[model samples]
Target: MTKKRKSRGRSKGGKGRSDYVECSNCGSRVPRDKAKKVTQRVSLVEPTLARELSQKGAYIPVSYVTKYYCISCAVHYGVVKVRAREDRRTSYNS
Candidate 1:
């Protein structure tokens, strides 16, 4: 068998098994290591109100939202880009 990616499309290295997570968009079950996780910080207050409060020395609260996407959904939503044959074999962090 031939390998398409060096990591086999999963971040679990030397681990036997990994947990599964549901995709936020399609609601499909995908492995935690294989799924793409995105975290965004959302402001509780509106931009205008937050600005006003900041001037008054009021602290604005923000919430963190995390989303997981499968490979198909990740590609569809432009979260991850398709790599070339050579690029697939190399790690971007290296």
Candidate 2:
């Protein structure tokens, strides 16, 4: 059988494998490079209360929450959107 050409921009030389991370929504293992990462800031105090406290010279601490999603989960959750035909990259030569 003949070898199939790589459709993506990746070259077909190396091991082609990568580290994996668990998807936050589906719990599926996805390659680290392929997973979508989202980081959100979490505040210990409510915004209104924090504003009042800050006006009174109080400080509020914030933490960052990071989540990873697989391609399917990301698409389903709106993290990734389907692009129109014209908007898609035209790397493949027909």
Candidate 3:
């Protein structure tokens, strides 16, 4: 049985304001709490990521598709299977 990985919760670090909030992609400055209100928390999983749980199993979260915004997480309540390359190789061999 595989253990489920939990989301990384935000740190309400002491009152010192953030130095700057930058876009995860473009590095452009995002308004305060704007990044906080992102569209979705895109999947950070990859076969090579050491910490990633098995991508080939039935337990994978469906949000791996649409954005997984922290606050609006329920938007993608349905989960779809995205085949990982690791599992795809079996089809070719079969």
Q: Name the candidate that leads on lDDT.
A: 1
lDDT of each: 0.93, 0.73, 0.37
| TM-scores, each model vs. reference | 0.88, 0.73, 0.22
**Reference-based lDDT, residue 63, model 1:** 99
Q: Is 1 or 2 the stronger prediction by lDDT?
A: 1
Q: What range of 10 consecutive residues in model 3 has the weakest lDDT sum? A: 3-12
Between candidates 1 and 3, which one is better according to lDDT? 1
| Clash numbers, per candidate | 0, 0, 3
Residue 94 of model 1, lDDT score: 77
Candidate 3 on 37-57: residue-level lDDT in tens? 335544445535523455444
Clashing pairs in model 1?
none
Superposed Cα deviation of residue 86, candidate 3 (Å): 52
Q: How close to the true structure is residue 79 of candidate 2, measured as C-alpha lDDT?
A: 78
